[model samples]
Each structure stands twice: as structure tokens, then as C-alpha cells.
Target chain A: MDISSGVTETTIKSKKTVKKQKITKGNMTPYLFILPSFILIVGFLFYPIGTVFYYSLQHYDVAAPFYNGFAGLDNFVTIFTQDKMFLPSLLNSLKWVVTEVGLQLIFGMILALLLNQTFKLRGMARAVAFIPWAISGVLASSMWSLIFNEHMGVLNDLLMKLGLINEPQAFLASTTTAFTSVILAELWRGIPFFAITLLASLQSIPVDLYEAAKVDGASRWKTFIYVILPQLKNTIVLTTLLRVVWEFNNVDLLFNLTGGGPAHSTTTLTMYIADLAVHGSNFGYGSALTVITFAILLLFAIVYLKLSRYEKE
Target chain B: MIFNNKKADKLITLYLPLSMMLCFTIFPLYWTINTAFKPEGDIIKRPLQYLPANPTIDNFVNAWTNIGFATFFKNSLIVGVATVIVVLICSTLSGYALARYQFKGKRGFMLMLLCTQFIPRAMMIIPLFIIFKNLGLISNPLSLIITYSAVEIPFTTILMSGFISGVPKELEEAAMMDGCTKLQSLRYVVFPLLLPGIVATGVFTFIYTWNEFLIALMLTNQQNKFTLPVGLASMMGEFNVNYGALAAGSVIALIPAILLFAYAQKHLVNGMGGAVKG
Candidate 1:
């Protein structure tokens, strides 16, 4: 026993030494492994952001001499005070976030709750429901655009065919209709996310809780209110926050479907920035706008993190 | 009595979802397919036909030839394949290290990766475009491959790490004890277990790269180099919308995504449903 114990003690000591060496080596290894990705991020994400921050203060032009003199806070002032489109675009984006994310969450939750039930062909139904998510955003926007086209749109035709309307409507030409059209397209693409995420959350809930509630003579509504809603609260909050950030930053749907058109009615911050950068050749101003957008999104992200913390407790 | 109630409850539960699934899910698809088959003039004509009165393949033919869809298809394929390859390699190595090694800052590294996803694509577009332009990579398909890989790496790594963790380390250690090198141990022991994860990640990478528009739109400026989305977008100008050809193009773009999802449906579903343990 003494001899075996002595042998085991030596093994343990050697093992500890090996572990210490391994730990140190392992620390370096992860950094080495992640080094390439870190370099890419720095090269692509960090450096450009830093450049944008710098450029935001400079008076640069895309064409006719790229270099310009320092102009601190002036560009920001121009955007905030001078640019008439800026405030309205920002408001439109805010409206988009509330409507798109809000409606997506409500509808998605309802869809998820319905899908969560055991039924024949449940898998097929779920897959069918997720088909819209499989379609690319640009394609989805284009399809909707065709459907909303003033003269050639199928929507008007369908409504007329069904006796829902008397005349063909110019959905994309009017400012109010154009904004509504963009929001609807966004919602169409976004609703699936809520359904999928909420469905996943619903699946995670144990069936025993519902069974137990039933055993206690709880009605169906009472069981859903007491058992389901409380459990889904975290998922709902997180999804809502994610949807807000995503919707706030969305560019393609509105850009493609509306072209921020009908006198720039649908031009959100992203579209505005892209317009300045790509079309207007005001890279410096665009970069400034980009920075501002990031700042706003970061603020929201911090709020979301804080809310998540509160939810955790 | 209880069994009957449960049955009735199940049926009741299915009713709303089924109706919603038909409306929100199937209607748009039906509309698209319906529009795709309609005569060019009937597409915008009043009183939308539930079924195309005069379906024709002319739009498909026009979309195929006029839009230069063949080139777009080739570009999308090359970029998608290249992204999958690069992502699989880089993510596998990083994921393996993350899963197996007891490293300092592992948690922090993961958190950092997750944080990257929150940074909006719009924020990265300008910087990425500038960086690629500086490197003289504008209009290059290879540039897109690199950018897509970079954008996809973090998620792929996270997914792979989850998968690699599920693989037993004892097998690797056992292989090592047999005088096998670390690389050999990983190749023989750990890699087989990671195949499903790699497939899942590969499918996602392919789909994302295939569907990606903004980066592809900005990066590749040449007409011949334009991917499907850009190609389709070029059809729209100040006036004269090619509804038939555009609808046809939209259907064409749907093919690869649908086929990919179909091929990897099981793994994709599993991956989406939290198979990525992290």
C-alpha cells in the first residue's frame, strides 16, 4: 500500500506539472488559432471604423481631389441641422423598428404557439412556415415590388378580381403607401425569425408544467397565461431587441423596393449613408453617418444587455 | 374522457398554425410561381388570375440569356464553394482548439465573436469596401470569397466548437498514447465526429454566400462579375420594368437555396434548433 501510494504521489505530481505546462501552452494556442480571424477583423472591421471616425472630422470628397482639410463637428452639424432628409429618415427608421419588430414579435409568437401543439404533419407545417426565411431579402423585396407595382402589379389585380377594390392603386408611387409597402416587405422577411426562435423556446419548455396545471384544474387560458407567457418572456425580450437592431440597420429591402423614393420618403439612415457614399461621392459625410449609426446601435445594444441582466435576476 | 379532451386540444392547437402556414407561407410562393408563368402582358394586367391564363417559357428564356444569369450562377457557385472551403478549414482549426484546449480567454474570445454578429453589416460595408479596394481586390470574385469567409468564420467556429466538444476527448488521448502525433490523433479521432457539424456549417456558409447581396453588390462592379442579385437589380432602371424576366430571375435565384436547404434539411434543422451547444 505504501509503495503504491508513493507511486501514485509521483504520478500526481508529474500530472500537475504536465497540466501547468499544458495550460500555459494552451493559452498561447487559442490566441494563435484566433490570430487569423483577429487580423481579418482588425483589417476589415476595426481599421475602417477608425478611418470613418477620422474621416467624419475631415472635409473629403469622393471625386475631384480626395483629400480635404479638417472639419470637426461641422459635418455632424450639417447632418443634424442642415440636411432636411436626415431627421425624417431617422424618424422613418424609428417607425420601421417599432412597426416591423413589434408586429413580427406578436405574429411570430402566435404562430409559434400554434405550431407548438402536437398535430399530424407538424414537421411539414413547420418547414412550410419557414420557407419565406429561405428566400433572399432582395428577391423577397423584388417579388413584393412586382406585387405592388402601380400599373402592372398583381395585388391590385387580385383585389379587383375579388371585388375588394374598384380601381388599380399606385401602392409604390405614393409616399404613405410606399413606406407601408417597405414595412410590409420587411415584416414578411422578419416574421419567420420570431416564429423559429419562439418555437425553439417553446420546445424547450417541459410539457409537465402544462400537465401539472391541468391537474390543478387550470383552464386552457389560465394555463397559457400562467405557464407559457412567463416562460416565453425572456425569449420574447431578446428576440424583440435583436429584431430592433436588425430592422434599424436594414438597407436592402427599402433600397430595392422603394429606392427611398417618392421624394426620398423612405430613405432611412442606412440608405442615406449608402446614397452619400456610393451615389453622392461624399465618403467623408457617409463615414460620419456610419459612425453615428454605429453609436446609436451601440447605445441600444448596451440597453439590451442591461435589460437581459435584469431579466436574468 | 381525458384522452378525448387531449385529442381535441391537439386538433385545436393545430388549427391556427395550419391556417397561418397556408396564408403567410404558401401564398407568397404561390403568387411568385403564378407570376412566373403568366404572359408578359398579363403580369401587370388588371384582375389577377389565380392561375396563369397564358403561361409561357419565354420569360425564363429571356431571363436566362438577357440577364446573363449563366455568369451570375457561375460567380455565385465559385464564391459559395470557395467560402465553404476556407470557412471549414479556418473554423475547424479554431473550433478544435477552443473545444479541446483549456485556454485562458476562451470565454472572452467566444464573447468577442458573438459581439461581432451584433455589429450591423452596414457598419462593415464601407470599411470592407475601402480595404478591398486598397488591396486592388475590387471586381474580384476571390475578394468576395475572402470577405464571405471572414463574415462567416465566427459563427462557423462557434458551431464547430460546440460539435467538437460533443466529441469525446478520450478517443483523441487514446490515439495520442498509441504514439500518434497530435495532428494524426485529431485527423483520425476527432475529425470523423465533426463531419456533421462541418456539413451544417458548410451548408449555412454556402447559403449565406449565395444569398449575400450588399457585399457582393459593392465589391464586384463589373457586369460579367455581378452575382444573381446584382444582375437582377441591373434590370431595374428609371423606367420600363421587365416584370416577366425579373420574376423569372427571382425564381432562378430561388433554386440553389431551395436545393441546398433540401439537401441539408435534417442537419440544417438540427443546427438551427440548438445543435450548436454554445
Candidate 2:
């Protein structure tokens, strides 16, 4: 027994020594492993972002190369003063982010709670519910467009049958209805994201917590308030912030469904930027707007993080 | 009697609301599919055919051949597959590094990754256009493949590291003690367990690449190089739209993403949950 014990102890000590040796040797393998990711990120993301700042200061229109030169803050001034779309588009972006994230979170929380319950066909139901999460923004736009189409749209057919409208309304073509219609379509896609994330967090909560709440004579609503929401605080805050960033940058649905149309009623800042990049031929001005966007987002993120105190937990 | 009441409550609280949500979620897709199967003339018939009176595959045929969805689909496939491969390799290696090593700049590297998450994707459009244009890779598949791989790497690396951390290091160490090289141990022991994570990451990247529009639109202007989303967007912009072929094109785009999501959703949800929680 002593001999065997001694042998095992020596082996363990030798293993520790090996580990120490591995660390002390200053292994290059890890750096080598991380190099490709580092290179790609630097080359594409960081380098491009850096160029946005650089280009923001220059007059770099592809159409008018003769006018191209350093234009120190001229583009920003134009955006704030000369450009009409900047302020309204910024407001639209705020509206877009708030509505999309708020509605998504509320419905998503409810969906997550429902999915968390023990039920038959739970797996299949989850798969079905998250179908929208997997569908591309463009595809979702197409699907919604088909429903919003005036002549052959099922929505028009349904509305007429209900006697809600005497004539088929062109939802996307009208400014008043276009934003809301797009929001509803995006909401269908956005909710599943929150549901999936919230459900995952929900699953991680111990059953004993619920049982403990029950033992304390807490009702279901009370239990949820006391037990569930607190546990979900971190996930909620993080996902909301992430979702805000994502939705702010999202132009797919807006671009396809409305083309920021009906007189640019649906043009968020991102959509405006996309239009400029795609068609406007004003790279310098677009870059300046993009910089402002980045600044706003950074400001929002910092303020939001401070407010949520996300790191406190 | 109390038990019966509880069952009724479950029906109302759980099944009723869930079904409604499901309807809202699935209806658009169902509507699209319904339209896709209808003949071109039947699609616009009065009272709007809830179901195609005469189901046909002609729209699919037309979309695949006439509207050039075939080329778009092939281009999307190439970009998606290539990006996924690059992301998997880069993320796996970096993830293994982060999971195993106590290296300098580790915290900084992690912060860098997190910072990338907050970088507005819209900010990349103009500069990326210039950079790629300067590189003379405008409309090239290589531009897209490179851009997407970079965009996807940060998230996938974090996810991959989480997955690798879940794999206990002791197993690999034990294999090393049993006279196997680190590479061999990883190949034999860790790789099998990491397969699900790799699949989750791959699916995530593939879906993003498949569905991405703005960058794809900006990068690839050629008709033949358009990905599915770009192609779909262009088709939507036409003066006289073909709803049948459009819906048919949508279903074609929808299938791969949905199938992949359905297949790997279990890992995806759990992995995402872990990532978000962190």
C-alpha cells in the first residue's frame, strides 16, 4: 500500500512539474493559434473602422474625384445644417430601436415563460417558434411584402372580409402605416431572438428556487417577480443592449420593404447611410454620418451600461 | 375536480397563448409557401386563394431558371460555405488558445472581441467598399468571403472558447500522460466532444452569411454574383414584380437556413445562452 501510494504521489508531482514547465517555457503555440483571427479582425474590422474616421475628414466622392481632398469637419457641418434627412432619420432610428426592442422583450419574455413550462411537443414548438429567428431579414421582408401587397395580399383580403376597410389599403406605400407595418414584421423576427435567449436563462434557474418560493406562500406572479426577474436581470440587460445595437444597424427590412420610401418616412440613420453608400455617391458625407452614428451608439452604450450597472452583478 | 381545473388552466395559459404566438410566427412563411404553390394567374384571383386551388411547381421552375435564382443560390452557397470554413478554423484555434493558455494580453484580447460586438455593422460599408475597391476585389466572391469571416470571427471565438472550456482539460492531460501528443489527444478526445459546438458555430455563421443583405448588395453588383438576399431585393425593386417567382425564390432561400437552424438549435440555444450569460 505504501509503495503504490508513493508511486502515485510522485507521478502527480511530476505532472505538476510538467504543467509548470509548459507555462514557464513561454509557449508560442497559443499566439500562433490566435494569429489568424487576430489578422482577420485587424485587417477587416479594425482597419475598415479606422478608415471610416479617416475618410470622414476627406472629400472622397467616387463620382467627383476632382473635388476630393481633406475637408476638415465640412461633411459633419453639412449633415447637421445642410442635410434635411439627418435629424429626422436619427429620430426615426431612435423610434425604430425603442419600439423593436421594447415589444420584442415583452413578447419574448412571455414566450420564454411559456416555453419553459413542461409540455408535450415542447421541442417541436420551440423549433417552430424560432423559425423566424433563422429566417433572413430579406426573406422576412419578402414574406411580409406578399402579405402587405395591395391587390393579392391576404391581409387585404382578411380586412375586407372583416369590413374593416372598403378598399385594399397599400400599407407599405403609405407613410403613416409603413413604419408600423415594418415594425410588426420585424417584431415577428426579433421576438424569437429574445425568447431563445430568455428561455435559455430561464432553464438555468434552479427548480428549488420556484419550490422555495412556493413554500414561502408566494403566488405564481409573486414568485416570478421575486425569483425569476432578478435571476434574469443580467441576461435581460445584455441582450437588450445587443439587440439595440443590432436593430439600429439593421437596414435589410427597411431597405427592401419600403426602400425608405413614401418620402423617406422609414429611413433610419442606417438606412440613410446604406442608401448613400449604394447610390448617392457621397462617400465623404456618408462616412461623417456614419461617424456620428458610431458616436451616438457609443454614447448610448456607455449611458445604458451606466444605468443598468450591468457589471455590478 | 381540482385536477380538472388545473388542466383547463394549463390549456388556457400555456397552449392557447403558445398557439397564437406560433400562428403569428408561422403565418408569413405559410403565406409565402401558399403563394409559391399557386399558379401565376391563381395568385391574384378574387377572394385571394387561401390555399392554391391548383398546386404547381411552375413558379419554382421559373424562379430557378428565368430569374437567375440558380446563380444567386450557388453564389450564396459558396460564400456561406467558405466563410464557415474560415471561421471554424480561426475560431477553433483561437478558442483553444484562450481556453488553455494563461497568456499575456489575454484580457486585452477578450476586451477586443467584446468591443467588436459593439461596432455598428453600418460603419463598415463605406470604408470596406473603398478597401475592396482599392484591392480591385469589387464584386469578387473573395471580398465577401473575407469580410464575412472577419465579421463572424469575434462572436464565434467567444462561443468556441466557452465550448472548449466546458471540455475539461484533464482529459487531454490524461491522454498526454498516456503517451499521446497534444495534437493527437485533441484529435481523438476533444474533437469528438467539440463537434456539436463546431456545428452550432457553423450554423450561426452560415445563417448570417446566407441572410446578410447590405454588405452583399454593396459588394456584389453583378447580376451573376448576387447572393440570394441581394437577388431577392433586386427582384423586389422591379417595376413589374412577379409575386409567384418572388415567393418561390423566398422559399428557396428559406429552406437551408431553417433546416440548419432546426438541426442544430439545441446546441445553438444552450451555447447562446451560455454566451449571453457570460
Candidate 3:
């Protein structure tokens, strides 16, 4: 009996060792698979970001000395003091984030709630609603550009036809209207993201809660306020935060539509940086702007993290 | 009585969303398509025609030749397909690793990847431009391909990781026990099951790379090397707006996206749903 038990134990030990070996082999294989992506990220993503930081500290230019001596915080100081467009561009960015993110979230949540109902053609309706999101940002802006065109735009033509306004509105040319038009275009493209994300969240909510509320003779508003809103609280906050970051960074729509427009009314931080680098030929200042924007974004992220924490506890 | 109120409430709920969506979604498309058919002169004329008065295919024909769209289409296709393939391959392996393996620095690496998604691409544009220019890759379509793959990898990896993790580990174990090599197990066992995810990722990567404007706009200098968006953007000059040709070009550009979305609608919906859940 003792000899038989010993033999079984030895066989079990052998199998366990073999299993360990196989597991390590399997584990190592996934790393091999991920190697290409790691290489790509290092080359394209990390390297560029590192270079931007490096250039931010230097007084680098195209025609001038390639890697000039470090300027310390001089570029940043110049950006704050000397750069006339800095404060205005920053203000515009804020306006964009506030209006675009706020409207998108509110409208999106409302729409999501409305669509979350058990209705015929819900799927078709959802798909159709999501179409704007699929449109390229550049194309969407261009489409809106036509709508807001000063001479031949549809908006002015419609307004004139309806006797709302007799003259053509220079929607994209005017400072006030330029930002508004760009924001409207952004809202059109962005609302779909909010709608889809919120809709998914809405769907995850079980119908049982509503049924329970109904059994208790709760009103529609009461049920939503007490039940639905609570369930959606986390999603609403996260989506809003996400939208803020995205809107703050979005440049293409504004760039194409207005080119920061009639008198730099719609110029954002991104456009400002691009102008500095590509058009203005000031790579140092552009890198500085890039660094500043990154810092601001990091601050926003930190604030979001704090808010998320507050919500949790 | 209860049933009646519920039905009415349902109708009311559906009505608001339906109308809002129509206003937001279908109206722009309607506007674009309508304008495409309108005469160039009539586009700016007052008493706005909801329908085209004199519809002409001339705009399209002119745009097709003027913008060199056929070449742009081919360029976009090459870049898009290459991006999709690279992202899929890289993401799948990385995702599998993140999902299945308990490795050192695993969490840190994932967090790093996620952090990359937050870094605005605009911030890195100048540096990337310089790097590509230095590498002599700016003129090549492969430059955009590489850029797209880099930007897309993190999101795709996260997405694929979630999907792969949901796959039963027991099945993989069984395959291993059957004397399958790790790669063989991944190829024959895990990969087949991840087809839906792969398709979704592929479609997404394709759309993003295809539609990407800023990087493409900046990188490609020559007219012949232009992608659709860049080509379309170049049409807009300071003074004179070519309404007919521009609208025609814009419409042409929209076709590939629309067709791809139509083809992959189901997968996209599923993929987006999964992403949100994750």
C-alpha cells in the first residue's frame, strides 16, 4: 500500500512540474505577440511626446541653430506675456468645452432616456441617430460651412425666405457668429457620442426597478428622479468628463470651418499651436504651447479624478 | 386604464427622441444631398430651394476629374487597409497578453497605454511631423499608416483585451493539454472565437485612418499624394469657393464611410456596445 501511494505521488509531482513549464511558455508567448505594438508605440507615440518636451525647453527653429541652448521657462513666460493670442485662445477653448460638452451631455441624456423606451423601430431610430457620429469631423465642418456660408449659405437663404432677416448673415465671417457656428457643428457631431454612450448605460438598467415603482403607484417623474437618475449618475458624470477632454482637444472642425476666423474669434489652443509650428514657423513656441496644453489637460484629469473620488465616498 | 397610460407614455417618449434625431441626423444629410444637386448659382440665391431646381451630374463629373479623386481613393484604401491590418495584429497579441497573463508591470503597462489615449494627438503633431520628415517617411503613405496604428493600438488593445478575457480560459487549457503550442492554441482555439471583435476593430481602424484629416493634411505635400480629406480641404481657398465641385467632392468622400458603416453596422454596434460596457 505504501509503495503504491509513493508511485502515485511521484507521477502527480511530475505532472505539476510539466503544467508549470507549459504555463510559463504560454505566458511568454503573449509578450512576443505584443512586441510589434510596443515597438510602434515607442517609435511613434512615446518618442514624439518626448521630443515635444525636449523642444519645449529649447529655442529651436527651422532655419536657426537646430538644437539651441536651453531657454528654461522663457518660452512659457513669453507665451503668457508676449503671445497676444494665448489668453484669447485659452478663453475660446474654455467656451468650447463649456458649451459643446454641456449641451451634448444634456441633450444626449434626454434623448437616451427617450430612446430607452420599449418602442417599435427603436433599433432603426438609434442607428439613424448615430449617423452624425460616423461623419468625419472635417466633412461635418465643411457641410456646416456651406450651411453658414455668407453669400450662398442655406441658413441665410432660409432666414431671408421666411422674412426673419432681409440680409445675408455672415455667420462664419463674424466674430460672434463664427464661434457659435463652429460650436453648433461640433455639437451636431458630438451629441451622437453622448447619445450612444448614455443609451448603452440606460439599457443596462433593469426594468424591474420601474415595475417596482409602478407597483408602489409612483408617478413617471418621481420614478425617474428617484430611480433612473441614481442609476445613471455614474455614467452621466464620466461621459461629461470624457466629452470635456475631447472638446477641449478637438481642432479639425474649428480649423477647417473658420480657420480661427474673421479676426481670430474661434482660434483654439490647438489652432494656435499649429499656426505657430506649421504656418508661423516657430517650432519652439509651438512646442511650448503643446507642453502648456498637456499640463492643462493633466490638471483637468486630476480634477476629474478628485471628483470621481468624491462621488465614490 | 394602466395599459393606456403606459402606451401613451411610450409614444411620448418615442416622439421626442425620434424628432430630435431626425432634426440632428437626417437634416444635415438631406441638406448636403439637396445642395449637391442644386445649380452652383442657385445655391446662394434667395428663397432657398428645399429641392434642387436644375439637378446636374456635372458637379460630380467635374469634381471627379478636378480633385483627382480616383487616385485619392486608391491612396486612402491602401493606408486604411494597412492601418487596419497592423492595428488588428498588434492589438490582438497585446490584448491577449493583458487578458491571460499575470506578468510583472502588466498593470503599469496597461495604465501607460490608457494614458496615451488621453494625450491629445495635436500636442504631438509637430514632433511627429519633424520625426517623419527626418525619417523620409512624410511622402510615403506608410507614414500615415504608422501614425494611425500607433494612435489606435491602445483603444483596440483595451477593447480586444476585454473580449479575450471573456473567453473561457478552460478552453485554452484544454487545447494546451491536447499538445498544442501556445501560438497554436491562440491561433486555432482563441482566435476563431475572437472573429467578431477582430472585425469590429478592423472596421473602426479603417474608418479612423480613412477619415483622418489633420495629420494627412500636414504630411502629404504633393497633390497626387493627397488623401480624400486633404484633397477636399485644398479646394477651399481664401476668396473663391467652388461650391459645386467642393460639394461634389465632399459627397464622393462620404460614400466610402457610408458604405463601410452600412456593411459593418452590426459589428460596429456590437463593438461600441462592448466598449461602453468595458
Candidate 4:
């Protein structure tokens, strides 16, 4: 009787402890797990974003801090009415986004479709095609710089050999060709991104749909239009929106290649802001520009998503 | 006759376009490599040698020892590895929580993560510069590491969550029923399966940190502290750039990213596709 009572008592205690453990795990474990990421993101990202707004209101030029104080609407006003570079740079940003993302999408879609087709050495071909995506913007700029170089560029040599140009043109230095050259270089790198994303979307497409289209006597072009395009709609919308934002902010190639120069012709808004932050010490004005850029991007995102109804099937 | 038509169609539609894309994709890389191996004098030699006549490693030696690319390479590696560890730890924990539990703010947290995708990375430079300056972390690798981790965590967290969700819940339950502790169950049951996802995420983060130029340029002023991209940019800005050394430096920077991509690319595509599809 004593042994049985002892065993029963210990079993009851263990059961109670298990219940307690369950309660704690259910309530606190997940929060604890999430705590580190929450802290770092909030401390670094979200907090810094808040400070951009705060600094935008004051004259916080690191070059001349003694003149810093509450400037109120002056910063925003200067950006709107007085700043000469503002409107031009904004327009340049629009042009840059349109050309870069548009061309990248078209070429990337073509590459994706081609890669989707079965052939020998497809895996190796896919790997080679996607290689440029792994390259950094700076590296791409350097590689293109070599090709666009006046003296040593293979491009100039080829163009001259083909009687296209009498002399080696300074592709990057000339204002007329600078933006286009940069676009082409960036296009080389950017196409791989779309190709990869779209290819993934393509892989997920049901094979039955294609067979059905074929059975319906659809030509390849007709099938692509009727079957493939509809399946890829969501991916296209999402990737394009993402790419628009990404390409808008992409200052790497422009910064390294042209430095937004040759009469400031290629100075997109983000590039202009980057120039301000780096070369100019006017943190306040720069922050103000940043705010405007942020608002424009947020507005664009909202309008784009609404028009596309990205959330809806 | 039917086969002949099919063959002609394939030639026009597939092989021709495919070859053009390949040339467009491969030419720059090939040119860069060709330039890297050529003697500096022959680099700009007229007739533009498609093949280097006198290939040499002098540029590589010069860039590595004298031009401070070695330092840049080391710095990039340090930042890349450290950022990967931090992102992996933080993201894995949060991913586990997101995948397994029923929490009140789960949906809100997910929405917040998605919202970060829209945050303009370029605009953050000024604020981040100030924040780092105030913290006295300018020119410090820790700042880059920490900042990169924060930048990477949301995406990685989502990725990890997707990967973790892919692991069957029943497996974990079975391990638990086998009298293993929760930690033990996870260690034995889930982690082995999650290794590929972890590796892909690490490579993705590493590549971003390695190639990041603008922020690295802002955060570090001392040349000794420069990353590969910053170093390359500075070299490009020099009045008389050594084209050979520049090409060599690029090849060095390009290797790790390309190698890592080649290794983890299959998983990366799937993981990224899954993440975006969600």
C-alpha cells in the first residue's frame, strides 16, 4: 500500500509539471523566439526611418551645423519651388525607371520563355544565362566600362571594323550616349533577375493547361497569349512592381559609371540624393529630398497595386 | 519533310535567339577575363586581340599585394560571414515561431515584413549615416554587419518560415511523442531537412553584403576599411586607372558570388519562387 501511494504521488507531480510546461511554452516560447529579430529590425530599420522625417524638418547640414535649427516648411518649399535639380532629377528618375524596367521585363520574359523550352544542356544554359545576376552593379559597371572604353573597348573595335563609326567613341564620357550605355550595361545584369523569377513562375504552371490548349488547336503564339500569359499575370505584376522600386533606387551603376555627370543628364532623383548625402553636407536638404522620394515611391506602390489588384485572383 | 519543317522552325525560334542571348550574357564576362590575362601594354593594343597574346598574372599579383584589394577582400569576407551568422540565428528563430505557433500579432507581423519591401533603401543612407556616426561606428565592420542583418532579416525570416512550413508538422510531433524534449526534437528532426534552405539564405545574404556599394561607401571613409565594390569604385575614379588591375580586382570580387550562386542556385530559385508565390 505504501509503495503504490508513493508511485501515484510522484506520477501526479510529473503530470502537473508537464501541464505547467505546456502553459509556458504556449504563452512565452514564440515571443522569446521572435524577440531578437524584432529588436534588431526595430532598432536599426524602423527607427532610422523615423529619424529621416525628424531630420528633414531641421537644417542639419554637417558642413555648417552652427546654422542648424528648426526650419519648418522651408526645406519642403525649397525642394518644391527653388531647387532647380529637383524637377529635372525627378523626370530623369521616371525615364530611368521606365526604360530600365520595361526593357528588362521584355528581354527577361523572352529569355525565360526560351529557357523554359526543353533542349540538351538546358541546365548548363540556365546557369550561364543567370550568371550576370550574381554580378554586382559596380562589377557590371567596370566590365561595361572596359567595353565602352575609348581605346581598348571591343565595342569600339567592332563598330569601327563594321564601318559604323570613323573613330572610337567615348561612350561613357559623351552625354548623348552615356545614359543609353549605362542602361545597356544595367540591362545585361537586370535581365537575369526577371528570367529567374519568371522561369520559376513558368515551372509552377500546370502542364495540363498547355496540353488542353494544344488540343484546342492553338498555335504556339495563341497558346502563349491565351494560356501562358494568364498564368503569369500575378508573377508579372509582383515582379514588375518590385523591379520598379528596385531600379528606381539602383544608384550603383550610375554612380560608378557616369557619376551622374556630362551636364548632370543622368542624375536620377535617387542618384541626386546620393550625391547630396555623399558630396554635399546638407543633411537637412538631403533628408527632405529623401522624404519626397519616399512619398513618391509609397504613392506609386499604392496606385500600382490598386490598378493591378495584386491581391485579387 | 515534316521533320525538316520542325527543324527549320526550331532553328529560327530557338537556337538563333538562344545563341544571341548567350553572346549578350557571356561577352562582357569573357572580355573582362580576357583583359585580366593580357599584358597591360597589350590591353589597349590596336586590332583588339580577341585572345591575349601574352597572358600574365602580374595584374593579379599587383592588385592583391599593392592595390589593397586583399584588405577589401578580407573586409568583405568578415562582413559577409558575420552578417550571415546573425541573419541565420535571428531569422531561424523567428521563422520557427511564425511557422509553428498561433500568436496574436502573427498576421500583423507578416504584414509589417511585407511592408518593408517597399521601403526605399536609397533614402535610408542619410539617416543610417547619422545613426552610425552618433554610435561612433563609422568605418566599423560591426555597423555594416548589424545594418545588413536588419536589412536582411525580414526577407530571410519569411524564407525561413516557408522552409520550416515545408517540414511536416507530424515529424516534429512524432519526435516529441518519442519522449524527446522540444529542443531535441527540433535538433534531430527539423534541422537536417532545413539545411539546404539555411545554406541558400546564407549565400543570398552573403552576396548582398559582398556587392553592396553605396552604404559601404557612406559608412566607411578609410580606404583600409573599404569593401570590394568601394575599392573598385575608388580605383575607377582615379585619374589614371590601371585597367589590368581593375579587371583583376573585379574577377576577385566576382568569384565568391558566382561560385556561391552556382552551388546554391537551384535552392535559391525554388526558395525565392516559393516566397514570392506566397
**Model 2 over residues A1-40: C-alpha lDDT tens digits?**
9999999999999999978987875479889999999999
Q: Which stretches of candidate 3 lie over 4 Å from their true place?
A: A1-19, A63-68, B1-11, B176-184
B67 in model 1: Cα distance from truth in Å? 1.6
The lDDT per prediction is 0.79, 0.94, 0.82, 0.93
User: lDDT tens digits, residues B1-278, model 4?
Assistant: 76698899998899999999999999999999999999999998888999999999999999999999999999999999999999999999999999988877989888878888888888888899999999999999999999999999999999999999999998998999999998999999999999989999999999999999999999999999999999999999999989999999999999999999999878866876898798
Candidate number of the best lDDT: 2
Instruction: Specify the highest-TM-score model's number.
Output: 2
Native contacts kept, each candidate? 0.45, 0.94, 0.54, 0.78
Q: Write the per-residue lDDT of candidate 4 for residues A5-45, one digit (tens) a residue.
A: 99999999989997786577779888899999999988888
Highest DockQ: which candidate?
2
Runs in model 4 with CA error above 4 Å? Answer: A1-24, A310-313, B1-3
DockQ, prediction 4: 0.77
lDDT of 1 at A141: 78
State the lDDT of candidate 2 residue by residue for B68-123, as single tens digits. 99999999999999999999999999999999887889899999999999999889
lDDT of 3 by residue, A225-302 (tens): 998888877777767776777778788787788888779998988888866665666677789899999999989988
Give the winner by TM-score: 3 or 4. Answer: 4
Q: On a 0 to 1 DockQ scale, where is model 2?
A: 0.89
